[model samples]
Target: MTPETGRQLRFAVLDMQVIDPPTGGSRQRLLGLFGQLGSATAYVGTWDWRGQSERKQMLTATLQEHLVPLTPAHFDAVEREAAHINGGTVIDVTFHRLAALSPGYVAAARAAAEVADVVIFSHPWCWPLVAPVMRPDQLLVYDAHNVEGLLRLGLLDDGARGTALARDVVRLELELCRAADLILACSAEDVDGFIRLYGIDGTKIRIVPNGAFAAALSPAAAKEREEVRGRLGLDASPLAFFIGSDYGPNGDAARFIADRLAPALPDTRFVIAGAVGQSLAGRALAANVRVTGAIEESAKADWLRAADIAVNPMFAGSGTNVKMLDYFAAGLPVVTTPTGARGLGGAAGAMRIADAPSFGEAVRSLVADAPLRLDMAAAARRAVERQFGWDRISPATGRLLASRAARRGPAPFFSVVVPTYCRPAHLDRLVAHLEQQRCRDFEVLVVDQSPEAWCGAAWKHGFPLRYVRTDTRSAVIARNLGADLAAGAVIAFTDDDCEPHPGWLEAARPAFDEPGVVGLEGLILSDKVGDPEWRSVTNDGFEGIGFMTANLFVQANAFHRLGGFDGDFEEPHFREDTDLGWRLQAIGKVNFSREAWVFHPPHRRTEERESLQARSRFFEKDALLLRKHPGRYPALFRAEAQWTHNPYFREHLLRGAARYGVTVPDELLDLIQ
Candidate 1:
């Protein structure tokens, strides 16, 4: 820990490229991470001596820099190798060369890793240089901007060499994954890929998403927008703008826009900015198209302000687009492909999702309608404020660092709490699953709210099982009653309908070791497809923010501190867990564990009348919840509305209802609306 800020640990970042200008996604993430950790040093490699002095001056004030100058001969050799690889269909040639570090660069990275408490490798290319020097005690973190192997494979054609290259990349990536203590993925999709492809421990991975440095970009006033537009040249026409570095994906998008889209929409002026502008240089562009090569950081906001709509016609990309975030921050309505929208999580709602064939029309539609553009721009800006704001995202990263520092001795004993209401079969199955848990030092407490004692037979289980009966019919009251009786230091909660995975307790218990973490929620996977409830519950985007009672864990002391769940939410089971989560979050951090798995099988409604009544009760409870949290209601309502109307969501709802023999009346649909 540093002397000034005792909580934040000192971090040293090793990167093959100097992140002075912070143009690309990798550099942007480096700047964001270092900005969050005040006391940090960055060891960057310089390509040549031409701009060595200028590069040093361009380093961000937040980071202490060490630039390792590379000889021209060494740079040429690496460039030659990259050029050879570029002859094949490898997408990110520049990124691949970073892995080929010289001996001098390796020594500098090793020396820096020795003094730092945590050493972060910006990309897998920097991994080998710092991995050899990493001490066992020092935490090694890999900030995976994208799944490099998958990106390469996507760009490659089907052939023997492609297969071999793909195989080698996967093998290398797996080794890098195993070497790091923690891996920060840019998106949940990357996390899923790692788990599926490499079988890496999910607990060691976190979603430290790419976000816009909007705060760093000065807000463009109305006068500034007008002035910038005047300086660029008089333009009353709607401008479709895109800005990106000279990466393959960006170059592809720029070519597509200049060759394909711009000709069709001749009325709209297409402005291509950044290094990608060079790719469109000699092409016969439409009269409306303009290529502005590499605008400075100071002029970025002005250019964005002058544009009417931001367009990302990306067909191939692995991670979240930082340019989309920048567009939102600039209050420009965006139109992008689903590929470009990947890893943006829920914030993708703000942008118009389209495919390659329909992308031009999407941009044209936004340009034609001023009202729609304004609404989208407003929503986009709001989404950035609520979700992508650095204030909200940075602390989550800091918590990861703080957790590493707070990890202690042997795991604490756990008290697993299950609140059931007249569900004997579900409770019995749940107990059987608990019996199969890998960790044996846990007690199961069942608080039954049934009129009669239905789960009394669970006492015969192999583990310590405590069954209690209560006359009340409230899930909240039952949870509070069970927490009071719990003897362990940690209190874990799961619905009676949920079946804990064999390693569930073993995976969730380690989170408590992290400092300031009061509550933990495990990944709740649906046992069956087309389960309507599973759509929102299984969304990885809601990892840190949302809470689900079906799979929740909280510290015993924190449970008592917050007075358990609110009694007002007892009758209506809806939002009761959410209300408690809000309170818990206020006091301390509540983490999400992708490893702590629980399978929630959809429960079929035995009686149609009861099902309608339950749905009505859910709506009633939701209304009360909205009244309680007035400020949060609008965003919650918008999110739910968006989910409800989504084609995939609707298909699930219809299919699940039919499969489960559940009937949805018109009244319920109207009520939901």
Candidate 2:
């Protein structure tokens, strides 16, 4: 969350990029989740080398225009880098400056540890050096984006130098899993492999698969076909295309296609795409073979449009193949190696799997059988449009983030309960703020303590607000009463006096996705009256101190389960919110969302303070705490309350008993009362 403004969870991503792609892959993957959750802040760190067009082209092709050129200078300046992408994009780019081999890179990354909530290492190779120095408060999530590859390149191999090196790398990754607060695996198989390989608990691992490209050129986009095919001059020919060029497996496949596949059929022309600036050995310049340079993303569809068949003669590679999805997106019948089809759950039926020699035969077979080719093409189009598109893929990302934020269960609509008194102008302002909010999924339930006439002006505002009237003066009772009428899956309670940011709901909503997070509270601060510099803890402009009820959102079922706020305390008092927070904490986890904040105007009254003191009497008396809730709660209540300096408590409460003219029970007064 912006610390002072109290909106958006800011995350700094550390990775290498050669150029930004026009289409979204990693950028879309991360940003789509950010848009759904609306709290994540991404800081991409890329290299600055102007040379190596191959590296630049791949990065540019993959990232398009979304790439941000970041470097060691950017890393040095970053106060804290939260999340890690590891080496997912390790095509031709090197982590030269950020390598553990270099002390400066390590130091720059280590410096980010000072300011992050979570510090993730994309690979195990860097974790042993990085994790030991990070703040204890910061959570470390290892993006095992490379788990399957790590095993294929590590534990499964049987060599001395290569095996030992892979083993060390695997060991490092396993160590990261052990030390991290969370381990994120990209696939279910990877998750299982990680658990089996590292012997880590299954509960600690999260399955957040990589996202697909965002462009959804439906099979019906004939304009894309005409435009792209016209540019490539392929509309007149029976074009057989094979993408993926430079990687070891792709290079091997390209050579195999040129040397083996093209020779078998001189009547059919083969177009090889993907490599822009490199040449491979064994590439035969036969009349049937044509090696076209990297195709523009816009023209990829056209090539697919003119193609008779798409062949993926991959010899090796361990993870999910992104090209298979691209071929599916282009609506082409694909012929792939087994390695190229890994982790694509249901996409197997959409394409034919063949080895290098079989790949040549499969292409020949497709050319001979028009009906089989047509069926496979239809299946590929349906598979991509239905199951492999970004629209289908992004929801899983949302669910993952939401699960992490809420930490309990699935997401539900939030009922934001605003308890108003005599402040009509403030209520109007709050209402206006609420109306402008980004997440409009929440319902506004305004529980007014005053007469209907006082809220008449607010009633005319025409916002979709549900009004509930109660003569009860106790804010605690009103909040609890509000809970009974709340229809949302989650209940957010904020005071009428506070002015929330437009993104407050946007920021807090994602925390619901976190595992074990049943309750979400944000940093609350006095609105504009405090010292500007000293107000925010980190000066990212967030009021980092309070988690007031005025800015708290709770799951509705959990809220009702805890019975809402206790009304025994005085109206507008301090301990009531803390009491509710304690109760909710007893039932499930309470997450402090740095992003979900509201601006509470500084207002305190002695009557409210005295009433709060009376509530503290109940908390201080161990007997009352024991009787009110079941076992194992009083101790936690004491700890969190003490740790946060519960406003209702005073050191004097521990000593005074007879002064109140009441005989206190020994258990309540004795033992650190």
Best by TM-score: 1
Count of backbone collisions in candidate 1: 0
Any idea what lDDT model 1 has?
Answer: 0.69
Per-prediction tally of clashes? 0, 38
Would you list the clashing residue pairs of candidate 1? none
How would you encode candidate 1's per-residue C-alpha lDDT over 271-303 as one tens digit per residue?
899988978777888898888898887677778
State residue 538's C-alpha deviation in candidate 1, in Å.
19
lDDT of candidate 2 over 225-263, digit per residue (tens): 666667766545556887764555677777777778788
Backbone clash tally (model 2): 38
TM-scores, each model vs. reference: 0.63, 0.49
Candidate 2 lDDT trough over 10 residues, lowest sum: 56-65
The lDDT for every candidate, in the order shown, is: 0.69, 0.55
